[model samples]
Target chain A: MQKGGELVERTETRLNPGYGRWTPFWFLAPAVFALLVIGIYPTISALVTSFRRYNITRPRDGFPFIGFENYINVLSDQTFWQSLGLTARFYVTVLPFQLFFGICIALLLHRPGLGMLRALARISLVVPLATTYAVVGLIGRLIFNRDFGVANQFLNAIGIGGMDWLGSPTGAFIAIAVMDIWQWTPFCALIFLAGLSMVPVEIEEAARLETSSKTALLRYVQLPYLLPGLTAMLILRSADILKLFDMVFVMTRGGPGAATDLVSIYIQRVGFRVFDMGMASAQAILLLIMTIVLSRLYIRLIYKEIE
Target chain B: MSTTLRRVLHGAGLIAVLCFTLFPFYWMVSSSFKDQSDLLASPPVWFFTPTFANYADIFADEKVFGSIVNSLIVATLTTALSVLLGAPAAYALARFEFRGKSDLWFWFISNRMISPIVLALPVYLLAVQLKMLDTYLVLVLIYLTFNLPIVVWICTDQFRSIPIELEQAARLDGADQFTIFRKIYVPLGLPGIAVSAIFSFIFSWNELLYALVLTRRSVQTAPVMATSFMSGYELPWGKIMATGTVIVLPVTIFALLVSRHMVRGLTMGATK
Candidate 1:
């Protein structure tokens, strides 16, 4: 038994210095260290803060821990409920249009013999991404203005009256959705183009040369190749749209009447504007949970076939 | 005729998209030239007499030039820190074999997944605790949380794409790991680094939320400066548009110049 123990120890020592070494930790420490302090710790702290009533105004009194009361209030609050509905509306309106426009443009540019047009299209698509969201909001603001704006000018040119896009609830929601589609369609298109470029040309050519069945080619040949990338882009875009804040904050501040308030925008107003840290933390925790849950579910549903 | 129909439709689609994208930017520049009353006209003005009063106001009242300088410094610092931190990390990942590697990688990227607004409150508290609010370091750290991952991700892609035999050949010549990276990999990967740096700086410069939450009037950046009038009693569309133009012009030019590289960098690994 003693000889067996000695042999085991000797084997472990030799192996540790060789194949299954501790080297990855050295490469990983700085990134993991920063992320822990900045990303992970803050999230855990936010979760803990949600259970306590923390008002900076009364720092002298200090925080009083009240377990789950904040969560109860947040879940039951009418304004919180409205923001939830508004966020859903945003996701519904913007995501489909984003996917459609993105896929359309990706397919359009996936052809041959349109060099200059394709180049111009590619550059134009990504310019919005380079612009800051606040500036983007303002750009959308100037264009969507009901009066003395280009949208109205175009409406007049088409023999139609311009509606107040940011002045009413439905109109404001539409305006915010429009802003989202404008900002992110390029991102979607780019991802799809990346995926499109990777599609096997011989398979496509085989379909074109050997068979003239467009539907069969699309339904089988192309879709399967593009599914993984489309899944990734969709999950990312969905999560991002749910957390949309900067543009809405700059454009409407949850606007004409809480119409454009996304989940993050709701948290920002509650936390920053009203100075209700407890309630805000509750909202933040909720949004965080919803985002994680939805993203995981989406990834699971879309990628299940691969697994 | 079928092909002709396709060409005309494609042409129209191209025009529509260009108009959709550039019209807003054009109006921003055009609106800066319009007078206050002209801006408020019932229908929007397509062609108008141009002026530079709005631009004059931004430079004069808001001290737009100073904010631009502030923006430049913060962005440069943030980009530099991310690259400095990220390059070493990327090198470690590309060359080493270690434990919990993938988990560590995914953890680094959780910053990108988790919303910044989630960290806004705690980061605000951490900044005050460290007495680092409104300092360049604060901006660097906050931007680093998100930007470092990008650098690591982009650089890792670039590093991995380089053939391993070259590194082996250098090693056989008695070159150490650090020397090999510096002498060979760094020069080869310089363009990728440039792309990554530009992107990090652009993201850092264009960020408004953290700057809005952390900084005050004295150390305010461009994005925060642009928001000055929205809180005022009266709206100043012309002056606002002027600031808007100034903020976007640099990024617009930068984006067009680096479009090809940006495409490659952003779409990294997605195709593969």
Candidate 2:
């Protein structure tokens, strides 16, 4: 016991700043450990497996050290190339349309409305975003079915021939794309709404005082402000679409002869369906590399998202 | 006259898009009620007497309630665990600077982007070895691949916003770091937790691939079971739609419930 105090608390007995400063790490220990196990371990294991041939049925055979053979075979495969091409098609087809429509809806919804109504509108828009892809895909398949679908019914009512959506290649692809855009555009719109709220009304008023045309104001001020949000949605959604699987899996199973298959579904087919883990690993590595490359470019182009 | 015409065009376009966006969902509900013959009619049915048979068959005969239970269990447990592990990590990253925090953050996010199917084989094998397949726990753990990072990322914002004085105040009061977190941070950051937890729950609930690979007969989730309805032409369209309506409607209701927090969570660090 010191002269001035009967007993001083051990923690309150301040050490050098460095001593207690690291205490947060102690608090952070469990989370970081778990993240490593759940996140890093399996990922590293996947990467390792990508290099080697893995067979679950013949586990006693062990994962042989196949080296670049898996990579080489995958590189030469026609289906892998086609799937990659389709994945690109999906990205090209969906991204711009979604961004444009999302922005438009956000603008319309930004008007003065009661909180409850606005909230209701927000909920209605967000609901599709939360629904699982499998459920959406299943419904999409039903809706796109030529004989039983409401979509074909709508088309038929207009004196147009009912299209066999899932039975054909292009029709099936478009149907899936449309389904995706439907589910995701609301997500983009919500992001846009978040972006819009960040716009300073004063800037618009100042632009108005300057007699800035609405188009000019939007072109210059609003669009510029929305870039970060748009960039984020772009990266996030692009990555998501590149890996589009469950929807396609449920909707078409990559069929009408592998028309709607994307990279992820291709990985699943090879790994699980065909039981070609080596080839599957190779294909997975290819997609992962491409995604990483694109993500890098995306980050470099729009790397201002530092928090 | 020209501006009015332009406004009219815009209005028409907006309404058209809204209806188009909503049509799939609308048709789903409608077709669920459509009779089989009417459903399969080449032109399809715009009007027919509504039928509860699909819902009846799905709930009563097909036994979809089990899948719903799976989805609920998976989503809820994953949310709980993600919060348990992710919150402290987020807090540490937000508040402290011992070492490697930036690297840790980047690593957490990179894991989020690695497509989940890549891990499916290994995880499947692991599940079999552990004999944990088709169970809620595997779904919860598999879900952490994305959900944990999400919790970590979302709470990073909230924890950053909390003034250090709160933590310091607790520390000065002889509270340990754990005590500080429980008493001070968890209470204040409950809203952020709620937002991310709802999202975490939704993510696991909606996740299909791991659930599909991990479960076969016993622990089928709604998403996995829903796929059975669309397998082939032999599927009864009305029954499929009814099941689809039941499966999706809850998620839609949930989305409405947490639209605000989800709005924030989806944006992550974009605005802030």
Candidate 3:
């Protein structure tokens, strides 16, 4: 038995190095345990809770199992559908503007001759990225205040003033979009700048020589290199927008007649304010399924790149 | 176009972008210092005499100071716990090729992608069951769901960049796996660790959804305190801005300190 154990240890050492068969396992055990407790446990519990009739207000009912009823209710609710639509609209509204301005700013910053100004601009970008989301919402409220907001002041400067930004549905939606774009465009720019940096210097110079047109060089040379980082940005940014709650929660509270009622806020209102756990958990599970699909695609792409 | 004209246009574009990005922060900080009259001016006072009155008001409110302390404690503990638990696991994944390693990596990274709203309800339920609601421990544990993944994701990349030959050399010197990691990997991977630590600190500091749900009064974070002002009938723009600026200052400083790693940290090492 001792000889066999020694032989097994030797083979394991050959496979790795100077480590026992269980060393990696021991090293990984703490994090795995933490993930199970902190990450997986709640998800599993949520899945279970989604199928029950659990409402905090109705404590005497005792959360009896009522499989599929909660899911059916959530699917059939008009507000749920409307909230999902608004979430999608919110994503659509901010993403393109962010991408366009982000790429444009990245191109400018990446230009070689800018020198000190480029460094300063990059530093400025970090400020927005660093600001807290809730604070951004507070800033949004101050910026879009009809009577005293800088936004109105600027609009007045350019001949379009006195817009009641957060008071009207259309205005509230646009205000949220503007705030989101302001906060995240810098993030997109930084990511695209990283992508641009990945483009080979030789390829860029050679492509420039072949076609003096900036568009041609960017289309043929830089776009391919940017695609992976762009994909990463899309996956992350999409996930964030899907779960966007804090800024809107603080700024509008899905207000002005639910004009900016993103799905998360809708769910929060149901789950916390209304104390409808089963319905909220069902909605959460559906959102979780969408996130799973998106993340799977992201994982597949990342693995392909790594391999 | 002439080269000079192109250069001039490029400079102008950069300046415009800078103004767009920094303008909010300027408004936030300047507004925090403005008295109500200046703050409520229709045209919005661009230049004015700064007042300490807003700062004084918020400072006098004990909740603001308490929340800031709570935020500091929760964020610091969360960062400490994530690094302590994540760095070793990262070292293992980076050094040893084991079965299910890729699966484990996928699981950890996917935790970040899971919307907090999904977890908030169940986590809240669990916290209530355990009688852990409104506690710092619950907040730290809930934060780990995201922050731990960040630590693992970034530190794995950091540990991977350390030369394998160094590990071999350490082993030959009679160092065990723990010793090698402790002596060689830890020192070599400090920058990555620092970046991850910064990311963890910033995220934990700024987190709102879970903090809002999980803690009520005892451990409400700075962001929650900042938002609590909104519940009043009349909005106090100056006091709110003061709270917002105080909450944002630490993170902005941290962000600038590691500006070089911003891209790498933000993308979770995908770009780097």
Candidate 1 at B10: error in angstroms?
Answer: 1.9
Question: Which stretches of model 2 miss by more than 4 angstroms?
Answer: A1-22, A55-62, A111-120, A294-307, B1-17
Q: Which run of 10 residues does model 1 chain A get worst, by summed lDDT?
A: A16-25
Tell me the interface RMSD of model 3, in angstroms. 1.1
User: For all the predictions, what are the DockQ values?
Assistant: 0.46, 0.53, 0.81
In model 1, where do residues sit more than 4 Å from their true spots? A1-24, A210-216, A294-307, B261-268
**A1-307 per-residue lDDT for model 2 (tens digits):** 3533323333334443322666777767787787677656766666777788786667788888888988888889888889888888898898888888898878766644344544455556876787778878887877787776767777877888688899999999999988988988888888888777778988767877886476787787788778878777878786787667888899889888988888898889888988777678667666677667755655555544453
Per model, kept true contacts as a fraction are: 0.52, 0.55, 0.89
Ranked by DockQ from best down, the candidates are: 3, 2, 1
DockQ of candidate 1, scored on C-alphas against the true complex (2 decimals)? 0.46
Ranking of all candidate structures by their lDDT, best first? 3, 2, 1
Error of 2 at B208 (Å): 0.7
- Write model 1 residue lDDT over A1-307, tens digit each, in one string: 6687556546644664222244445555677677677677878888888898887777887889999999999989998898888777777778888788887787777766568987898888868878888887887777888876677778888988788988988878887788778888887777777677777888788887866776776677778777777777766766777667778888898878777887788888888887778788888878778777754555355435422
DockQ winner, 1 or 2: 2
Q: Top model by DockQ, which number?
A: 3
Q: What is the interface RMSD of candidate 1, in Å?
A: 2.8
The per-model lDDT (C-alpha) reads 0.76, 0.76, 0.90
Model 1, docking class: acceptable
